[model samples]
Target: MEGAPPAKKMKTERQFDFSKCARRKVALMFAYLGWDYDGLVVQADSDNTIEEYIFHALEKTKLIESREACGWTRCGRTDKGVSAFRQVASLIVRSNLKEGPGVFWPEGTNAANWKETTQEIDFCQALNGVLPKEVRVLAWSVVPEDFSARFNCTQRVYKYFFARGQLNVDAMIAGSRLLIGEHDFRNFCRIDKNKARLETSYVRTIVNVTLEPSKWSCDTASGSSAYDMLELTVVGSSFLWHQIRCIVAVLLAIGSGRESPEVISQLLDINTHPRRPQYGMASETPLCLFDCSYDGVNLEWTWQPRALNATIVHLQKIWVDLQTKANMVRRMLGDLEELPGASGDSNGMTDYLYCGPPAKNYIPLLQRPTCDGLEDKREKRNAKQNGAPQTLLTESL
Candidate 1:
């Protein structure tokens, strides 16, 4: 009996009867730390994305047969390393709710005893259990059969946070207002080759734009503005590839007095600047998809007791982890200050520009600095099209 290979255990996780499950249209609200992912969408080159984990959980839970069958549509395809607080996705999923004359009717009129018979699927509990700690399924809602997360979304909110170096906060605010209406933003975003193939327009409308101090800043007047975190909030119908980051880059330049606020106007004018200026975008580490809005959809989010407890524990652990590192750094700096001549301030000549400033020989942006634009891309493409041998295109991060 000992040599009989121990009577193999049945694999319950992978093998499931999906055909017997009832399907319903649902939308899931998610929050995730995207630093560990290759962005939200599943790509051919990588399987480590947030979407991959969601689908894996769905499969494991026997929620659906395949990703395609779910008719899944995401509200926004956030960039890599960009976090999200209110990401939403619509899909067809397996449900255990009962339908009848009045209860769970197409018209949404529920019977008195409908609540007693119908039961909601524990989507968050199931997915959170299987998903990595960086990602979490916040809640799920029963949506209409015709609901679409992408098209039905009324607006999207994006927030980018950064330290306000020597930049002008008021000037950045003034420049942000110039983006409030519809405009051809070719200069504010990189072209998406796939979308461009269909002759898509670069025109998009900005509903609102504002820059304010984040909670990280101390209220005291003596607090260092260079270390104070500022938040750029943008609300729009839709956005282009790297649009938010490009805009942030421009604002940073404006704040630094390198460019006037009118530069935004000049760049937006098609006749003035058809091609985008060459400039590095803001870092992706502090960018986030803050929220997505839907009109007329009353999403009732239900949290199970066990799942709620698990979420509390998970979040507390993250806080503690950060707190420990912060405390260690604080203590280390205090100890260093106690050393000889270590507590003294820097000399007036050794001023720190935070991010923009550098050592004595550092070139400023006001100087004639080179930047890549559409013309550069056009020339390369033309050369290749004209029978000139070209290597595969590669780019740095």
Candidate 2:
């Protein structure tokens, strides 16, 4: 004992029995318009949402009994009324779905009715048929077990649209530059009591944030207040609740000269006390998650033209119907009010007349305490491991 060296402890590693494992790994690229649903995540007994459609397809395909059972995780949690052009979700299923070339379940319900038909159908085709028009399952891949749609993401790009009205575009883009780097964004996001479980580092880096004109001619569209569209794109590794909207509000303020570009720089500085600035959060209706990327992961995906094409056809019919109604309304109100200007405002000043004055500070749209206690403990452990400073807003002390 006096001269002997101590032995190094061996770490235990997890081993899976492939033969015994019934779980089939899967990843999906889905697109959805958040206007109708409550949110993406499924809440039992809650109304229909994107996750609900996914789980329904899973159970119908005999994939998993429940989302929890499937161990599903998503790339982002877009707010209600928001949308996603390319969102990803990963999960495991129990079936022939992962086997090469022949996975099928017949039409109609099963004997138990806990699931749908046992007919022969490709996994993607079956799910698309049952899903709603606003939501679509575009592609899928069977990824390694370690792959996480959320944790493994390299970059997430989001776009927000605002009607230009009287705001200045050049000023907005200038303010956005101040946010390009690592910073503690406590001021921009909602302080989630349960965030300790999801993220240890509140200091996420924003790779880029840019503002550009919408595809529609702002000059032509500005003649009608209802048609003007201004777009902002944000790219980052991760974002907290309400962060993007809050930042948009800040930029809008600066564009209108209600707040200076220096305000954004001040907010980025940790020493700036009263972290939350009083500012307006942009409207949620126009925000969309354009894409989410994972580096070095080779994923196979396919488009469902049959389902998507049908949806497009149906949308066109609806659009034509709406156009008729709009024309009638226009005829009824002919020359009643002054036509809007080319810059999206009646008077072309850099003032946001309808949006009101900018706040000296920022506040989240909603704030609530997390119900889960386990998440609180996780946050503390992560913070300590990551060497991040603790704060009142963070669950970890």
Report lDDT per candidate: 0.74, 0.66
Tens-digit per-residue lDDT, 1-397, candidate 2: 8989898889886542233223456688888878778778777667677787778877665556566756788998887677897899988665532233322233331323223434323556667677777777777777887788999888999998765656667788888988999988876765554644255556889999877778853544214544356678899988988888778877766776666777787767656333354444676766899999988887777555675576567567766786788567655544444456423233422233224554445343223222223334455557877999744443321
Model 1 is weakest, by summed lDDT over 10 consecutive residues, at 346-355
Worst 10 residues of 2 by lDDT: 365-374
lDDT assessment of candidate 2: 0.66
Estimate TM-scores for all models.
0.79, 0.70
lDDT of 1 by residue, 81-137 (tens): 889988999887766665521113333233332334366678889889899998888
Q: Pick the candidate with the highest lDDT.
A: 1
Error of 2 at 148 (Å): 1.3
Candidate no. 2 TM-score: 0.70
Q: Which candidate number maximizes TM-score?
A: 1
- Model 2 clash number: 13
lDDT of 1 at 57: 90
